[model samples]
Target: MSEENKLSVLVVGGGGVGTIVAVNLEAGGHAKVTLVLRSNFSKVSRDGFSIRSVDHGNLNGWRPHEVVDQVPAIGFGKPGFDTVVCCTKNIQDSTPSIEELIRPAVTPGYTTVVLIQNGLNIELPLVAQFPQNVILSGVSFMGSHEPEPGIIEHDFEDKLVVGAFRNPGTSAALSNARARDFVGHYSAGGKTVCEYTADANRSRWEKLVYNATMNPICAILRTDTATLRLSDSIENLVRPAMEEIRAAASANGYNLDASIAQRMIDMDPMEIFFKPSMCMDALKGNLIEFENLVGEPLRAGKKHGVAMPVLTVIYDMCKMLQWQLKAAREGRSQEDMLKVYDSGKP
Candidate 1:
């Protein structure tokens, strides 16, 4: 496609998932991909990306159309992004939220926002913030990780479920049209699969069977899927958490059957050894997505008076683990954490 005719796409979070998205979109010869980077900005911009994958075999020095560290302002005669795909790790009510982080690049009524992160009802803030823009809920079921700067490893399935995020905010016609458009760009390379859904929240609830349970449990245990599946954690912790999630989602009117959790658990085979993103983050001493994956669901359960005892325990454990991570990163001791606690400050 020519410059004037091609879509301008800005992808935030140039990690494993974002890099894959940018590469696939750029390779498709459809849209112009501008990638936003964080810690790995300096190295990636200079040498580009190096990917070792099960799908797109061994990509070297792969760069997008434009690589930017900071998001460019959308207006004032500069061409704004046609779509912004945020594949970042979502923390609930974080400072400088995902909406604000990507706000400057949003062209108000024009730019469509696509969230390809994990969580339940994560689109609420963005929905409230940018009511005019088309907000897409991208439920990604891929496993690609960046162990070091500029190197990505993809071994899991590259599948995406794309659709309108929540409610009937934008016209149904416009919502479906934009979702199909993104699916077109995303699935251009035959290596990946993308599907469109009218009710993306349902997809999210289904995915929570894995995300809310296996993801957090694996992280807390600091183990891989094979280990977790074999251990007592799967029966004692994982399934019950999934049941709670199912109950909460059903309470909110998205009804998923009881078999869904067991089906998800059986989907991945036992022999294929791999670590989910949360576990990897925990082992790497980086902050894991505790709130988005676990905390928010608990809150929802509380609001609806759903019994989430299993998830409540998991949430508290993950919360302490996250707190310990932060304290460790700052070189603070557990006693120092108690100081903050004893002072009645958060």
Candidate 2:
């Protein structure tokens, strides 16, 4: 496509991270930016989203060009988007709207989809539904949150990694060029973005290794990542889980560095204090993405014959908590779920 024919980008999910990407893109002069939010978040479009950050000081009073609760079900009107960035959660079973929004945008010659979720399961399903050539996987280490409606606080500096899946041989030039453009824009906003290996599974699994060790433990214990980093009890549990994930990664032919956790722990204390998003979701009683974040790794471990006893235990506990939460929502008891969070005592 010629430069004039390149359609603008649309970002699905108007939460903190989504807002950051949208704002930064606009700030970088990418004028044709549209944000598609869930019906519940439409109010943000009118009220506008605000972002406050220690790094950038504060970013508020910015508005998106177009905001809708759903993708244009009637098809992207007139000027179709050349790219769609998905910043939705990773819960495989609860993402129909995200799927619907991405479907039309994946038409072969147009629209590359960039996924910025936390887990590793979203890509396969997307590729199954569309073309692998059009899919891009991205990982962001940025810290952010919504203190209230129309307000997002950026808490930390984050590096972003973008790349394509393996052996698809589908427009590598296009993928790399887009990734470079995205990184440049993010960097301009004082965020770091880079190109990772084409081996997305390895990069994804490496990230999952960290999340599996940190996110759930923080959620179950109800603590910040820093506190977990400092605790002997949490560290004890986490080390074994990391070992299991490392073993699984090895089994899958990906060699992870031994110093990953130490590097993470060595980061500034303020950065460490940033809480995992899952903890935030649990606090709001939102459904957790247990399957993608926890369950998939467990399954992969078993398939590879790698032992992950700690992860298995944590997965079972999280699953039970999720079940109880669902049951309570349907008029059952939440005492058990509450106990899991309390007993672990992170």
Candidate 3:
């Protein structure tokens, strides 16, 4: 294919997942790929991005066609990106908001927005704003992280589940061509497993069963998934929270089987040992993604009148912990913050 005829893609966030996608797309040599990185732009520009992965092998100095600081820097000069992949954390209070971050790249008529984010209802805002854009909801089970500024340590798993949003006003065929072509780009290498589903909402709920249960437990307990899986937390806390999530999804017109919880629990110990994003955020003093993961689902349960007592308690603990972290960052010492945080405790 001629260079002009090939797809032009822009990947936002430049984190673990972003680096993985950018590297693979460039390796495929089938698309015009550009990456938008913030602080790591200088390091990545100088040394390129490195990926240490069990699946993809050790790769160093992986460079894309172009690197920019933000979306506006990419002057696509046409309708902007044909495909925009978002790999950032879905923090509600983020300065760019997810909407603002992708606004510059998305072309209303043709761009396909791939949301590789976690939590429930994350695509709502984008779907509402860009009704004309083809929106694909994706759930990434890939284990990867940026240990430092420009290096990604990928443990395993390349399974990315993607599906179109069945919005009432949007046509299912709106960006079908772009979505299929984008998926084809990943089909070349056997290293990555990309599954295209008809129902992305169901996929999101399925991933949520595990994320909602383990992420908060790890964060609040200051432990890792391995520890949570081996302890009473699984039976007493994890299982019950999973059930609540299942119930909430069902109430929202999505059926999540009881087996998902066990399936996630049965994941290999290697995955269990790693810290989830929420736990890492808490430890790093970054804003925890409580709203989408816990708070949003809890609110949905209330709206549907479904009882989520187990999840409610877990949600409260996560919220309290987030506030405590915030207090610590606001110049209060950990000891003073803990005293105030635990004031009503026995």
Candidate 4:
């Protein structure tokens, strides 16, 4: 594609998932990615990004087409993004609401918004806020992390599944066309794998079989996947929770195979000590993604009258632990976790 034909893309979220997407798009030369960053903003903008990946090899001082801290509020006479790929964690009612954060760069009828995030039912808030834009649902399976500022380590091959999230008052043609265009640019480099799915939500539910089970268990247990793999709790704990998730998905009309729960566990490479995002967040005292990841799905399943006893137990612990982390962040005692029922306490 020529320079003018290149897609104008905005990437928010600078973690493993976001960095991989930005670097690959820049490498492909099909998209001009303007990455909005935090934490590593100074280091990356000054020295560019130093990336090490199993697929693309190691890159030193690699910069996207445009690297900015903010997307710049857009209005008449101002440009907006052609595609906004939000790779941030789903933390709505958590902090830095993705809807408000990316509002400035979203053009009502022009910009195609892609959510490369986790958690079930995460599309609703963005949909409610940006009803006029074409929103695509994306799910990524990869092992990548920023071990240090401006330095990325990607050990697993990145794979993506994208499809259009149902947008009210928008034609199916427009949504599907934009999703196809995104896959083209994403796969132009031919390094990472990007696949198109007719129903993006099925993929998310399948992924949640792992995310809602293994992720939160590892967080609550304060262990890594490698450790869990070696433990006898696979049948006793993890798989039961996963079965609940699959049942929950089925209750909601997304029928997953009975084997998906076990497949997610067996697929992870044995050598790597895979620390999921929730586990890492717990270690760092950050807010665990309970609401979207566990809470919403649990509620949905219960509403459908699916008995998810194992998952329900996991959800309660996740919410309490999440509260403790937030309380600690606010300098409140962990003992105050139940005080929320008394009055306005956080």
- Evaluation by lDDT, superior candidate among 3 and 4: 4
Write the number of the candidate with greater lDDT, choosing between 1 and 4.
4
The C-alpha stretches of model 1 lying farther than 4 A from their native spots are: 167-169, 333-346
Q: Candidate 1, overall lDDT?
A: 0.85
Model 2 stretches with alpha carbons more than 4 Å out: 1-7, 39-42, 54-57, 74-77, 95-97, 167-174, 185-192, 266-273, 331-346
- Structural RMSD, model 1: 2.1
Q: Give per-model TM-scores.
A: 0.94, 0.85, 0.90, 0.95
Candidate 2 per-residue lDDT over residues 3-81, each given as its tens digit: 3633477888777788777776666564456788774365676677767854455665667667777775425456567
State the lDDT at 74 in candidate 4.
79
- lDDT of the candidates, in the order given: 0.85, 0.70, 0.81, 0.86
lDDT of 1 by residue, 1-346 (tens): 7878888999999998998888778777788989999899999999989998777889899889889998878777898888999989986546678889999999888899999988876888898889888999899888788989999988786899999875356777898889999899888777789999988888988888788888888888877778877878778888888889999998888999879988888767688766778888888888888787888778887899998888888889988998888778789977877888889965
| Number of the top lDDT candidate | 4
Candidate 3, residues 1-346, lDDT tens digits: the string is 5788767889898988888887777666677788989979999999998879766788888778888887863355554777888988887666878888788777775678888888888878988888777788778888888879999998867788878875555688764555566677865566788877877788888888878878888888888888887778889888888888889999999987778889887764755586788999898887788888898888988899989998888889988988777777787886876788799687
Error of 2 at 262 (Å): 2.2
Ranking by lDDT: 4, 1, 3, 2
lDDT of 4 by residue, 31-112 (tens): 8888988889999989988888987998999888878887667788877778999998876475558898999999887799
